[model samples]
Target: MTTETMQADDYFYEFFDAVSNSTDISYVQKGDVLLCEKTEVNQFGARVLPTFYCINFILSLIGNGLVLCIIYKYEKLSTVTNIFLLNLVISDLLFAFSLPFWAVYHHSEWIFGSALCKLVGSLYSIGFNSSVLFLTLMTFDRYLAVVHAITATRSRKTMYAFASSAVIWFISILASVKDMVLFDVQPGNQSMMLCEMTGYHHNIMKKWQLIGHYQQFLLFFTVPLAMVLYCYIRISIRIMSTRMREKCRAVKLIFIIVLIFCVCWTPYNVVILLQAIEMSNGDQKQCSDTLDYALYMSRNFAYLYCCISPVFYTFLGKKFQTHFLKLLAKRIPCLNITIVTPTQSSKTTSFRTPNTVTEH
Candidate 1:
């Protein structure tokens, strides 16, 4: 109650609007204690609770599920690069699976039991942290592949990547277990009770909550972001300077991944961080209409990024598209496939396709 964060029952209309049109300036007001109680929802906003959760659930299921299916179906796609993808899809699915429960908690009263309330909320946090960690790692992997060719090719490097993923998942689970067990539903709040640090064991709960936030920042926000930025800078420089034809595919893949990272996550964290700072001071400051609007806007756009991640593979990752197009051509019997052999006069080859391929 005293910490910085929007209460569980915060409204949606302003939330969406604020996030969509966010400002670079911090929303934190000095001398604010976060002790706001929920009031009646007097028929405002377009019932964003259900809409937000439903859209996120459906998108994550379809898109992340497809990514999983693609990797599992094709043996060749199980490379070092795609292993990171598999982690990403799995993280998205973990987050998405809990959306329906949240939607129910929002649309209908929290009819799903207390056990589910804690479980869903905890998993959501875990998935979010894992997603950030994996995306950052994936960027680093790409950066290494492009910048340090021999190291990337070594067997030990691949082993180390897998080892790192295992550690990330292990820590993510441990971080999540506390929420799953310790979250106490507020008295008489129906389904509105989400994960919170109860004052019952104030000292312990506060420590855990701060630890969780710090861990999330370390793995997800701060360190990973710095790594990603550095990697992208190095990668951009390498791509611009080098004339290596073979490296083009890898460069494009990394570029799209980096772009998605910036677009999806930057807004949500900014809101939370600023909110936290404001709450640390002792005033229960009401979120300005502008701040509320930006926070919600970021929430919607953030999930869209998660859902559209699989599509990035189709458009930007060259290897995925090649196999996918071939498969699509096979599925549509009416479509003709054209094959041309190399004319080895020079070091170049040419091929003609019968139709334009659409990237998913």
Candidate 2:
């Protein structure tokens, strides 16, 4: 083995941290080969990542599942915006499905076999890419629905939404094919067999890796983020000018979702982009402990988007909150709550004697 090999593993994990092989085994560079010196695991990562994954797994699964149920239960919830949100939930679920494997891997090593490795890696990429795409699309959808209502009303349809979702999912899955093909199970620091990228010819592996990093940064981060900001800016300006109370509320909700998305993902993308560029120098230079720790933390924040999104949806959408309460009331007979739907001139929604009405 060589330092180059270790560097390759680090880069792979930088982009997709949860199940990527850990750099536990320490080594030193010799004249031409690298000799394994000791098995020094990252204690911080070992302690932090598993717990983070477990919590995210529980919250995302429950929250996203409830979101799906609410959407399915109410016809009013299936608008163009909510349709995009539905797919967003589905993508987040895809991300969550991979977390248990990641949780286990963080506590120990990659106990899963080669096929599972490729499957999990591909799923992670698919989920992440599709989720961003959906969010970006949601921003555009909101911009049109708010800014150009007439045109948007004519074009937004259930069939069209499903068609767009299919295209995004197709592209996302296609982007993940490289991960499925390149990653394989290999011997790790100890007796551990780890799953990581291998089999690239030396002449082109560097170029290939660089290209992959650039693709991820562009497709997953830069382009979508830029579009989101631009759309939301225009949306904010348009909504501010309008005196519609509902639109004002909608603006607040959109702001929360977009802000959370950026806060969660931006740092992780930046760190990965910097790391990819630095590693491309082929010097086998290791990153500082500070940068390494930051990467670990940033990746966790990025994963938290899955859990955080449903929380925002629940809190922001009055209809969603009402349905959620009704659903909750069903299980707990003592919570006989009543919900009143909003009327055009109703200034405020009110609950009846046997029920409670909640406003957003």
Candidate 3:
């Protein structure tokens, strides 16, 4: 064979071997010969993603932590909506806890070993699924409170809220089982270790990854998004018909919550869908390169949702804002701001804070 043919053959052999060991290989065609190319996605991720992850970690930690403390100190979890809020905060915190590890992993190798690889992978899976589920539940809770208030009164109890949260947690754990089983500390380019799926035949590994993509796209994104849209539509119709401007105002924050969720997650899931399609169709170098950049950027943007959620979910609430300011003033006596606690009247007693005045 000629020198060029021999070089192409060598490239094929190297590609085969790399595929057998790792799924991070891409192919580019050079002068009618397909050559395996190691993508610089990791290097790019190292430069960009670690900064984003670190910022998200700090903001999510402090934001969700303050939400938790405020809920525990000032708010009563006697209402169903409050219970769901508590669960959502917990989910965000759980997800936030995994970011520091991922930030470090992107910056360097997976030095935490196999056990932590599985644990952190599973934590991310569970946190993401649970966070989406809890948001959907909260949206539904608002729908009932606004559209079917009387009919939902008996069903929307704190006990039922706890039961629903338990079920969501169970499903989230089930979703993470696959990650726990497949993720490990695997060798990557230049002998670096990565926390990724391993321990299966190359073909089988690709199938499993594809399955995960579809599972997340369908179960976490498509289904929940549909439910949220339906609930909000019904809520809007009910409120408009009743001419309750206050009711519309009450749900404005909830609408913002759902909007933020959609804006943050939709791009990431769309990228995953495109990636699944690209994987099934074999390698397209340009497409693969584009996807790698899109995935990292969009995923980091989605991570910011956990941090922004606290502001819309709790801080904007009238009572929560008052309580938080009071706490702040107390912490810094130099501010000397006086916060008056509103008296509990019969009208206000019917609702839990002005945010969800429609809810009993």
Candidate 4:
């Protein structure tokens, strides 16, 4: 293949990256002819994606930041689940912090240097991977708390929680090493510098890209999702058997978290899986445009997870609501916000016990 052919192939593989910098051009080949067809996708993306990313960034920042502040101010980090929730919020914030740069990149070009390019790419990888891992840990913690409440006490200590979180961070960093090593600022069409993997030939790049897609699909989504499903299923069974309203409510909140995670990420991963299959079978040109569009739409939709998590994880909790209202009242003394005492029904449904795993 000539240089032009290689560039076209590279652009196709660029979709494998979390933050792809490719513009909208579909390369179609005929006998002794190369056709470059321009689509509205790039223009559409430039107009829409930056604004969407900015909105997502602001919402995720405020939501996750509020959760962090509330956790620090009112909630104790003694519980294993609390530790996991704290780490999860931090991961979301880390992911959100890169959004403005991406918004700029999508709107224009990569003005940032190669170092920052790699850093942002790694942040994307690390934050996303760690969020899933921490969520899975939280689900398992709840599982142990609800299912084997007596036996799990020995293992659910704060020291163990910290150790587990440290290990998760280490794993997330290791998972992101590929982005750190490969991503760089490279010149694209019309002198636009793109932050993408640039040095490898088309075939080599495709191999690595496939590896990345599969790695993310398996490690980030598949395995963690499986664990979450199993934990939640067991928790549901335990709750059903015990008929404990408190456990049911606790499980319901965590279950919604897991459900939202799956809903947000599943479509993107499915698109990636289809793309991977197409690439592996040497059928990249078929449905290339369709997959490109699907990838963009689904990936943007997946970003909603970070923004939505704070609501389900913190604000929906009765305890968190009370704490937030109290904090608000303290901050604004003129506001007559009265803290309501727990009614009998509220007490019966309360999941905030020393032995239970509650959302904070």
Candidate 5:
């Protein structure tokens, strides 16, 4: 804090000096407050990392944004299932909003202030949690329709669907806000603080961090996964015994959505579970490079689900697909790439066709 200490610490200047001094490639390691060792490497690969991050961010942004724009543009796409799809798109779009800033953070220092940090980080958690929750809900809807045909239709009304979604999002918000509150920049470290839960209170941080991660697995992964498996198992049984072709369509959609959900989240959850096991086993050291890389890959690749979710809707849901084709026609005449609908929605009503059944 004193002038002497300030003069003694010159990491910023040293960093630039080392970068400028090396003709080919250089690296700097801070050994102490004033002593920094600079080595000229074959190549300084730090810049390439940020570039990759930026690329991923751009791709995810365009994908998620397009899904949202298309969903909102068309009227026929607005059904109950599409409503859920809309909510999912909104969450992904919001998450994409933070990716550019994250790309910047990956390359450089945290130029954004404390408030934006909190906002962005919280939004990230909220969006991911929301996505997971909705996937779970969608699976359950399928279970209800395919397994418990008569009950599903009467229970899944428009108002109740909206209410359920609202409640799920509110819970997600509550679950995610802790990450923002706990996050803090590592003292005296320039940039390079990635997203993780910080415990403000001694043991509190670790306890809460572990809880949040596992909670994600439980609510979003374990329970929902169980329900999905059960739904499909039962649906398969019914289909085989009863000889119903229409039954196949509902289960098919459900299966695709479930597969998509698992694909999107399995890697990320695996990484988290690994960390949890390590911590629980008393390995308090920094993560191994391989583990860190796995986590990074999981987080980065998870965004693919954003674009994928809507596409599945189009593929499985006849009503939304119907509207989507109409919009494509309109789009051609205008010579504009105007988007049509956000959802690939199903048109099945509460009432079932004589021998056929539809799931949520």
Candidate 6:
């Protein structure tokens, strides 16, 4: 209450603020007075990441849209595997819808506001979760069709596929709700509004981020990966014993599918897991700077999966390629396209047959 006491308190506060601002590490202040101190951001991301996202967005949109059109235009391509591929396409396309926003976020600030941030972030999560789940489901469907061909044929229904898709979407949306709740627009050190998680406190933010990274590792990377590996391994073993002449190509496609998924996502997941461990274990200062660099590069590569899935679809499905070319011919009028209705032999017993197409 005295004038000298008030002056001393003011001086102490100013000195503390000066020390906090002059320090290298981020500081946590008790009061709401925000300090804008210069901290290093991953400059490589700003320089290179936007281009990757932009290319992913364009290619995924076109490729997925083309697949959807082909599926709708042709009635013979609605097998359970194709249906799952449809879901995968939809998931990737929806996720691709968020890439433009993310490209902007990486290149500059998050000017899209909190609600849009939540929407876009949530969509990204849903897309990724659903994409993984769909791939898992597709592998299982193949397993059932190959190993338990009679049961799969007798029990298959369009309604069953639709119901399963509904459940997948429900689970994916539930997973993404946390992202919507956690993400918001917050001020960064450089006076930029960033759309990211900023907890009510620094400790809470770190805890939540670590939890998120682990959650992604388990759900997206580990569990589905295990399922895919199991199903594909069994499918490979079973196909080897069968009399199908296309066994080599089938096995090759299976390997490519699993390989692409793992190669694109595993490194990114590992980087995040290492970052999470470093944060939780209190080795932030000792962590390698290359971790930050790897995070940027791996993430860009992982995001490419959205565009890459459609490439797999186009390459592996001869019928799909035919339909896709036909669709293109219809649109462009100058290209000559021949239509081929693929006939499957009875021995083809896999879910990829004329019967499977007809049933759907």
> Candidate 3, overall lDDT?
0.75
Which model scores highest in lDDT? Answer: 3
Number of residue pairs clashing in candidate 2, backbone atoms closer than 3 angstroms, sequence gap of 3 or more or interchain: 2
Candidate 4 to truth, TM: 0.84
lDDT of 4 by residue, 1-360 (tens): 001223244543454453644632233322343433423655666788889889989898878877788888988888775788888888888888888888898787899998899999889888878877877777677778767878987878999889989999999999888888888887776787888865665567688888888988998889988987888787777766764546667667656666677888899999989888887887637434677678778888778775656545555557777878988999998999999866776654454432233432
Q: In candidate 4, how many Å is residue 345 off? A: 12
Candidate 6 residue 8 Cα shift, in angstroms, is 23
Q: How high is the CA lDDT of each candidate model?
A: 0.59, 0.70, 0.75, 0.73, 0.59, 0.71
Q: How do the candidates rank by lDDT, highest first?
A: 3, 4, 6, 2, 1, 5
List model 6 lDDT by residue over 1-360, tens digit each.
000000023454567777877653333343443232212334567778789989999888877777677667874435566667778888998889999998898787789999998889899999988887776777677677767878888766777778888988998898787798888877764577888865454556667777789988898789888987897788788877877677787777778778888999899999989888887786625324577777778887788875667556444655555666777788888777777655665324323621121111
Q: Of models 3 and 6, which has the larger lDDT?
A: 3
Residue-level lDDT tens digits of model 1 in 21-87: 6643223223423443433231111267568778878877876765565567653433566666777
How many pairs of residues collide in each model? 18, 2, 0, 0, 8, 0
Candidate 4 colliding pairs: none
* 4 or 5, greater by lDDT: 4
Per-residue lDDT for 274-358 in model 5, tens only? 8777756756343244555566667555765653454444445544444556666676776555444333233334222111234
Error of 5 at 137 (Å): 1.0
What's the TM-score of every candidate structure?
0.73, 0.82, 0.84, 0.84, 0.71, 0.82
lDDT of 2 by residue, 1-360 (tens): 111243234544344545545643223222344433322325666778899999998989888887778778763445565667778888988988898887787677788998899999888889878877886776677667656868887898878788999999998998888888987777766676666666654435556667777887898889988988887778778767866566666566567667787899989988878878776765444424555677788988988885656555444555556777888888887877777656754423321100111222
| Candidate 2, RMSD to the unseen true structure | 8.3
